[model samples]
Target: MSTTEIKRIKSKVKTNSKYVSLITWIVMIYFVFSVVMLIRAAFLPEEAFTATPGLIFWQITIPINAGFSFNINIPMEVLPNYEPERFQAKAAFITYHSIYLLTYTSVLLYGIRQLTYILWSITDGHTPFTINNSVRLRNIAFAAIGNALLAGHIATICISIFVTQIFSMNILNISFSGLIIGSLLLVISQIFRYGAYLQEQYDTTL
Candidate 1:
């Protein structure tokens, strides 16, 4: 690409970095807010939990053709008539929510930190393709993969708890988008490493 194009791309990356930084701060604040809210909910009066059912209705469907399918909605309200258990279930729900939020926020912040480093490197007038940047990219890629796995594990655990403990049901859903994106980033990191090697050779010839 031409110098102008590279400059434009760098400018864009820099701008996006600012946005990412803003989001990072916002997420941090929101995380703290959520923790506080969870604490408050945990301490809420028993009467405040009068409306929750310790159960979830899962709709399952299996497609046999383009338009034909079998469907079932399992409504498991095990503690429907038990007020104390329902209140306890609400507390458990808050606990799970808090745990999920903590894990998610931690992973998000770490990824954002890696991204911020890349953006800073791009805008620092240094050669964009360097060994350090390549490593940072690789780190971010691996972090993405780890984040996805951790999230899926946490979700599975929480779902299991809700299903078995609260409603005696069972279900699972896991997303692989992070793994896909991380694979792409891993490829990009290899490209950056190669670019850094070439840049080093060129500098040596000079």
Candidate 2:
């Protein structure tokens, strides 16, 4: 691409990044609110614990000469029972979810902060292919992967806890999209690394 085209792309990136940074801040605030709500819900009286079970439903359709679709709903008791042992179980569950939420939000905020930094660098007229930019991109890739893995681990623990103490059902959920996005980010980070190396060589030659 020509220099003019590159400049135009950078300008767009900077604008979009500013908007995304704003959204990230908004989400962070919402997360804090959610944490407060979770704590409040956990401490409510036994009579106030009128919560129901959570259900996971999935449907898949195949289109071909012979097409078939099936829907399945799996229900798991997410709310704590008011019994002594069950109430203890509920407290443990709440603690686990709180930790997971905080950790997940922290990872996302770090990634967003790195993205904001990169955007600011572009807006400040710094070349996009700098060593710092490459490092930031790599951190983002790791954060994405970490978030996905952490989510899966937390889900598994949740399922295990509920199944053993509250219900007798199986639940498994993992975000394939998150894995794909993380992989793509990792690839892009490598590209950025190469670009930074080339930029360094160019600067040295000049």
Candidate 3:
């Protein structure tokens, strides 16, 4: 790309990174609030249910389609049926959800941070086709792919210990989208690495 085009792209990425940063902060706040809710439910299930009277935090694992479950809302009257009477079940549910949330959010945050760094480098007039950028993209791809493939399984295993008793756990979210996107990112990273090699060769010749 011409220098002018590259500059324009960098400028755009810089502006967009600010918006991404804001979204990351919002998600962080949401994660904190979700953790707090789970903790309250673990200790005081009744109190937590009272706060969100109509909704219950449980999942049905029978996927309606490949890797995705039905999202139909349950009747508010049915909420009482799902509530676990025993504290152990409630605590197990909390633990299951907490681990999954922590894993998913951590991956998301790390990917965004790396992306911001790449954008900042471009904005600072560093070439986008650098070895460092290639590595960052590959890292992001792996992290996302790992989360997509294993987060649900890990959370399910944690909750499965209390399988005899029904636990109020969110549905296992095995996302095909993450897997696809990660694979695409990995390919893009390889392309970037090749571009970096070419860039280095050009510089050496100059």
Top lDDT model: 3
lDDT string for model 2 (1-206, tens) is 79999889887997899798788979788778667656665665444322233333211111112443211122233232333334333344454556556666777788888888888888887777888888898888877877766665554456456433544322334456777888898898889889989988988995
After superposition, candidate 2 runs with Cα above 4 Å error: 1-7, 57-93, 158-173
Model 1 weakest 10-residue run by lDDT: 71-80
Q: Over 4 Å off in model 3, which ranges?
A: 1-3, 45-89, 162-173
If ranked by TM-score, best first, what sequence of candidates would result?
Answer: 3, 2, 1
- Whose TM-score is greatest here? 3
- Candidate 3 residue lDDT tens string, 1-206: 79788768877988988998898899889778667656555555433232122344444222234664322222222222433443243444455557757787889889988998887878787788999999999999999999887776666555545432433444445668999999999999999999999989988995
RMSD of each: 10.0, 10.1, 8.5
Give the Å shift of residue 129 in candidate 2: 1.1
Which candidate, 1 or 2, has the higher lDDT? Answer: 1
What ranges in model 1 sit over 4 Å off?
1-7, 50-87, 158-172
Of candidate 2, the 10-residue stretch with the lowest lDDT total is 56-65
Q: Single out the weakest 10-residue window by summed lDDT for candidate 3.
A: 70-79
- lDDT (Cα, tens digit) per residue for candidate 1, span 57-108: 3333333357764333323322223444433544444645555576667777
Sort the candidates on lDDT, descending order: 3, 1, 2
lDDT, residue 184, candidate 3: 97
